[model samples]
Target chain A: MNPVLGRVFPGLEGRSLRAAAVVTVLGGLVGVIGGESVVLALVLALAGSLATLSLRGRPNPLAEEYGLLPAIAALGALAALATPSLLVGLLAGVAGLGLLLWNAESARDTVRTAEPVEGLLIPGLGLAIALLTALSLPTASAAVGAAAFAVVVALALVVWALQGALTADPYAAKAL
Target chain B: MSGGSADPGPLKFRPRAVALFGAAGALAVLALATHNAVPLFLALPLLLGPAAAATGAPRVPLSFRVTWSSEGSRGEVEITGRLTPSAAGPSAGVVPTFYRPEPLIDRAPPEVRSEAEGIAFRLHWSAPYPCLVSVARPMLHWRDPLGLVERPVRVEGDALRLQRFPPELARASRAPLRRTTPLPGEVRARQLGGAGEFFAIRPLAPSDTLRQVNWRATARAGRMLANDFRVERTGDLLIVLDLRPTSLGSEIDARLASVAAAGAYGLAQSFLDQKARVGLALYTDFVESIPLASGRRQRYRLLRALQAATPGETAGPSERLAVSLRRYFPPGVTTVLFSALADDESTLVLPHMRRRGFPAFVLSPSPVPLLGQLGPRPTEDDERALRLLRLVRRRRIAEAWSEAAVVEWDDYWSLSSLASFFARPAGRRAAS
Candidate 1:
């Protein structure tokens, strides 16, 4: 790692944060390529960068840190507006938001311990994306429509809450 | 990894958490109004981030045990400790932030090593100068997984206070004690007729004891002869540190003061070891003196005073040392002065001390040599000006020799010369 970049992302010492960064970039690229909007790609990339910056340099609160989540959400909304397929836009936006949040959370404090938070977050996010993709597929039967989509969303939320409670290793949580 | 960073205190909700929820809510409202699932999906992570962080909040209170010890004056501080949670619970790891004040130069932070028992860390802080430095106990920054909450717990321990000075100073006991007080001590006084080093054999007196009779001397004299030994009584040493500001400027004056303090500490320690009554007088705007006393308590007192001395507004007249001496010390006490003798005023103090019956020895840490290291001269004219300044300083010190004994101390680091100088009488020392 570059010394300058190392200082900016002190949490990068762990593999989890590096993986989060790679995942966020890949997700952002997928959304931009799928939607065919270069502008959305740049905006999503900026959002990822902003979230990363929030956890940078000595764990003190950055002046622009609070704007991170809102900025990512706004970028997602823009992606939605640009794409013809709502599902594609949603997947891309969700992927960027999820990965960036993971990256930020992986380094929560300055501790350099392995993150169990990633275990809980990554699986929950993967399950949500998979269910959403399955429901939105055109090959789906007529029975799996808006009603079915709502049911699946509710089930995913329940699974997410259950997963958080069960997989929660409170002691395993370490500093970046 | 530097310990100089600010402390991130106790567990509290971060604004980022509020922003995450707020953004999530706004996106959700937009999704409902537009009847679009895309905006709703965008809100998922932001909402879940804080939600998951909330669930994983630290349940057990965290604390740490930190202790520090210094090897020597030049050695680094060895800090070791372990982190402990209030209950057998969360395996969450926390980074403890160490506080590094000015004069502490190390860049590396404490390295944490987890053992079978708990999380332990070790740190070493190398101080570069002979001065006092205090490092605060480390603060454990316990952060929730998603960084939604932060709690900085101060470790249970006192701050590490390290007083570094030259170890050679312990040899200050070898310094000669020419003058002596009436009190009993280790060094031999000039007077005869006591149980000490042999002085001379004299005709027997009526009160002389049989043990005092030197049989060989009596046989040579063909009469009763007695042995007269020098009295082994202690001496009163008043170490005066001239803190008065000189023309050398505050920066040089501060360095000079530091040097003087180190020198004074060594001399005091040496003399105190020989059972001499050592007192201190810091001659600043007025005068502060530690009354003449002996033993370990006096050594501690002198050390405490030297550590506290700082350079600032000190321009006391030369007469203050003399007048203060009369009040706090005996009239004919042996006085050792630590001064830069940077100006005429500084040189005058020794004469004042001598006039008042106090035999004085001036250890002048030369400011002339120090000025050379400050930096290069800007131009030839500046170089010429510095030369003239040096000449003037030389003349001032030369004039001071006519009054009291003076030793020009050019080198700051090496105290061997000063140690040898202290062993000899003021009359024998060559003028600076």
Candidate 2:
């Protein structure tokens, strides 16, 4: 993350306060340039890059990890900043990012997490998929497609990261 | 077989699978809609590179047998294992890893070779102290050549429990000896001088190693004559080890312990080679002893005793040795004590052992020489005190030599010098 972000914003490591500023400004500029609604796509791209970069060393990087998450995160970020209802758009984006954060940290935490949450997660995912298909039906608005993409990719990544965390036995790999 | 290959499982996909297959699909969808070459350029190699590079992998279960290397010793052992991998499975992955359990002995990582027969390597556990060892072989990742696909497959290597033995026995010197032990052996006896290396040719007798019937002597005597030889007598030897904790610091403590163990085992091996009944007593927190015995089995017992240190029964008091000796060893056994004698209890136990009628000897590694190997004591005062304490211990050992045998080896001396104690008699030794 440090090296990649360094190429984007000189002298700013991923951990720096200014890196967040770079992400915000880049996300907002992409939205403003791509005619308003594209801001959500830009947000999804930025968010996806952050999440995947953070999970660099994990055994298997998922399809959503490299492709859909970044796209979804960029779209969500744009929606947060450019929507008429800024508060609602920000809430939706933050909620979606929160889910991604949980997925990212899943590789580190599994023992204390509830198993029932996963059971519930499956149904919640099914409903989200149904909602996504419905949104794509009204493909006249690109925002709807971006929102559905964001929801589907975020759900898929959550499961993928959790399963990966459970399977990767770091101690067993070295067999020390 | 000189070498062989094995496949434990099937070929599996990795992230490049995502990149090659998943990314390619996404790029195709995007390219179809936009007719864009930019995305194709960005995604093509990202997807194809890993899958292509990984022509495939070898997934094979591995099995191995552990044995002593041809060039290893009783005190320092080297181990070699024949590791054979099973045939390639549905998928190809790397073999399960073998690692060092602990740094008890310094060793390189297990070396591996995949050949027609199997994978052969020496485990990093080469020459670890003789004990019950613990090793783990877990399933490992098998990635394609391009690393586009990876799968976790079960490792089929055997989990082995090995009883480590001393490296190799050193030959005993054939010099005449005066042994008082009641055990039978190849040593020349003190009083029972019959049935040995030809003392004289007499009339035929029983219990003679054939070829003892001297045909020439019998022809001259006009009678069937047999050879008489000095009786080969086996003596009882008690090798005492002191593994008590000391103030010399843990590093030096470990060094001295190794020296003590090596010296004890070396001397024991020499004695055993001469067909002597050998016994071992480890004086640590408590006394661990292997009763008097001879032969290869006894050697194994002695090796096991050397490494059988329990946390509670180790790194503690030294005076416990006196009590152990009183209870365990008979009074007349030729007892040899191997210790640094850092504590008064150990040094003091020496004279008492001699007084009890044991032909007691001390093989102590003097601490003064090893001080140079140490970085420094925490303080100058501590350093001064350490040297002083060792000097006092040396004086006490020197005083005991008149009543008993003593071989004081300098810790930093060469192995040949230390080994001289076994090749020759002690500087001052007396029959008990």
Candidate 3:
């Protein structure tokens, strides 16, 4: 196996590889939608690969030296600004934000099991994308009047109360 | 079940969590700078991940129970944890801190899997030579679902200690015993009037049996007489480990100390099996000794002492061991000194013990094998230097041999030669 590939995939098994593959497909999808330069695709691929390799506990000097992650985000923002289609910009933004979180998760001393993180992160990213897309709708934002704002505030208060009520008691120690 | 309190410290954000928050803040700032809503929307995923993880992170009480058993050199460990819905629960990724990489050997990484009740893993470890190995209580690692944070929960229990001796040392049961204590045992002693090989005739005592009466002696003397025989009793053995630093350096001394500890364990185990009272003395900056006694519990005590044996920074005078031996162990008890005999000070230890009336033996682990294994000589002149060093080592062993029986143990894997040396009668003082 190539050293680079070994570091990126680590036995070519586990959730990290699957997650990297998904990130790659999302990057490719964004590239097709934006009709941007090949540089965007290359940047996305590099970021995804770096994120995957980080899980193998190898020191990554390249990511640090070039600030590759922030650069990718900046490029995505620029691509979104340049493209004419709103859909392209939405996908680009989503991809950039998703890649940043992925890279952040990979930066650890040991390979992490994906069972716990995948279930939460995948849905969280999807929910964030959906929320962003819904909020981006001009008609929906205009139609929502003072009544919607009051409703939103009421829901927020209810969530806050629930969060407080659900907090576990620190005194209740359990043994295995 | 054993349990410990979870750390009461504030929640520690993973580096990635910090990075997530930083990325969110960076993108939000970029959105403000560019006067565009798209960049702001792009930062949502980054902000949402850590927020979700933090809100959902387990604060509910959790507990873990870890147990292990030795299957040859490998330890099979099982971990069971009680988890609330708030926690990520137990998984294969959670590992104890005691799992460390061994030098010179590329061990197979431990594989953990979810079992019916908990999780199980295998840890492969061994002492390449004879030595005592200790496993300390390890900290259990736990991570949140998003891998955004982690907590290290310490496992509470007694640490495991084991002694790995060379397989050849098991034959030490047949080792010759010259001195015996007052306790009755299998080995013959110098004293007469017991059920063993006949010695001479003596006037018949009330305790003398009809079979022990010597008719010829009785007829010649015209008086009642009985056959006397050598008594069978147990012996006292004191194993002393020389932990003083050597000229070879700390690294090599550590290797030598491991081999010596193993050798000491082998001798102690064999002697203890033969019903001999076995004690241990570790001579470092000061003499640390376990008093001589015979039983299963004494074996455990000696092993625990050996587990802590390591090479020391400074060397105590050879006479210190002799003085300690007189204070703790009985006089004329056969004392075996495990030393490399690398320096003249070590060479003098056996003689000092002998002067103090301990029948001393030196099981010197030769450092010659370690030299070859460490690496090749760095320069052409280095080879000559090593040769001169070998000559000096030989001279030291020779000096020690004059004082007591010295067995130069060059092999680390087996102790057949040492066992054979022990098998020979102790009256014949020779070197191998």
Candidate 4:
């Protein structure tokens, strides 16, 4: 397994190999719209294969911890696939954001309980955000796409911040 | 530990600076191209706002978390560490180095190796970045990076205090009492008797039945004597722990404490098996008395107190031991003192106990005798070197205790050894 691919799409290895395949196929479809589908498909296929291989023989705590992130991404992708409508895409985007928020809250609670739940959630959210961002671009104008990318980035930052802060000193004085 | 170097402060707002420079360059280019003001409009916010934010953003406080299993004499243990931006929040990029003060047996630098489980940072625009570190063994060290501006903060939490005691060796000494000694005010043969297995035989007392008389003894003595037998049950045992700071020399103080603790453990087990009441009186100069009762509950209570004991620096050796003995311990009980006997104070307490009618057994894990063979110098320049030497000496002292039946622990042994040593023989002896 190539370390680079694992780093790029952290929690999407394992059962999510199918998800990675779907993403690769979507990239190929994009290439079809622009007449370079073969090249896009090859690169995506390589990345997906590397990701799937990296997941083997490894305990995917990250996968379990952030299971909802991919689920939410899949939902968004399904919604986009169902209708190319701008409104539906926007609603799907909101749903992805909602999933991110849910994961963040779940991570915070897990830290409170001193459990390793965040291990799954962090990478799970990373994969979902990356996939959804890639999927949402077609329906949006350049400005809107940039804005959406910024929002996703901001959300990632928030998740990182929350994980750091929440786990820093999870238990209060009374709990100790 | 080396003092960490200074950090290159928060990152400069280079984007804003470039933007400002670009704006001026663009204005000049535009003027050269068409004498137009269009370039000025593009450069204003680019040069100012982001650069201002970059300069204005608060530095993220860097902190760390270190979690490991309990410490003991085990050869290997796993430790996990996490480095995160502190309460101020995540910044663009931050790397943390994990440090430990214990020995590590790995060739890799003391940095986390697996970024998958490593620290994850949120960079600008909320992108997640991960970093991993691997440690080969459990130890004590620190984590600090090249730049020290935002120093790594230590996350404090419960640390497992695993102190390995010395080994337990079979001792040559044995108890002199062959008969049970009974307490006064009880007339029943089972309740009132001397210490050990045998009771007594006397002329059939008013309450004694004819069947209670020992016919063989009566025939030999030619009298109607009743043989009364009592069960071996209650007796007193006292344990004195030496907490002098000097006693901690050469031995990892925690391990030294553990060895002393093991003696108390052995005594408690012995007393419990014999159905005798056992009491504990723990003391250092500063902490004079933590008197524990003799029973099932007291056994646990004593161990708990030993676990919490730490050597204080204030008192001299003799003064501390003397004060503890005088203030604590019940009168006339069998006393057992566990110490390294490194100082005069602790050694003198034994003779004092003897004068007071309590047979005090001194269990010293003193290293003075073994020090000559163990090393060349009294001290070393390296901190780790000194600690290792101390650990060796502590184990030597533990070995000395194992030689005496009254005490327990062999040199360089661990808590498990002490546990096993006392388990069988102590049980059998006490049951008898």
| Predicted model with the maximum TM-score | 3
Best by lDDT: 1
Residue A137, candidate 4: C-alpha displacement in angstroms: 20
lDDT at B408, model 2: 68
The per-residue C-alpha lDDT of model 4 at residue A121 equals 43
Window of ten residues with lowest summed lDDT in model 2 chain B? B62-71
Winning model by DockQ = 3
Superposed model 3: Cα runs more than 4 Å off = A1-18, A21-36, A40-85, A93-118, A121-176, B1-11, B73-98, B101-106, B152-158, B178-232, B374-392, B426-432
Q: TM-scores of the models, in the given order?
A: 0.67, 0.51, 0.73, 0.38
* Cα lDDT of model 1 by residue, B33-105, tens digit: 7655555556666666655555444444555666555563343555565665533434454655666654555
lDDT of 3 at A30: 58
lDDT (C-alpha) at residue B227 in model 2: 73
Give a tens-digit lDDT track for model 3, residues B11-121.
Answer: 567666676678668776875676554554456565665555544434434445666654453122222222112233334334344433222121344444445464455
Docking class of 3: incorrect
Per-residue CA lDDT of model 2 for B87-154, tens digit only, reads 33332223434333432353443444444554445543344333334344433444433223455555
DockQ of each: 0.16, 0.03, 0.21, 0.03
Off by over 4 Å in 4: A1-176, B1-234, B244-251, B255-263, B288-292, B310-316, B340-359, B363-408, B411-432
CAPRI-style docking class of model 4 based on DockQ: incorrect
Candidate 3 C-alpha error for residue B25, in Å: 1.6
TM-score-better candidate, 2 vs 4: 2
Candidate 4 lDDT by residue in tens digits, B1-432: 111222324444332134334433554354335432222222222222222223223233334444444221333323334433333333233333223322222222222332434352211110011001122222211211111012233354344333332323212112311222346222222244333345777777877766677799989999777766665444555667766666445344444555566545655655554545555665555544555354567766766776556566555544445445555655665566777656445556555555654445555553432443434454544545556666765664454434323333334343343344336666325322
Q: What share of the true interface contacts does candidate 4 keep?
A: 0.00
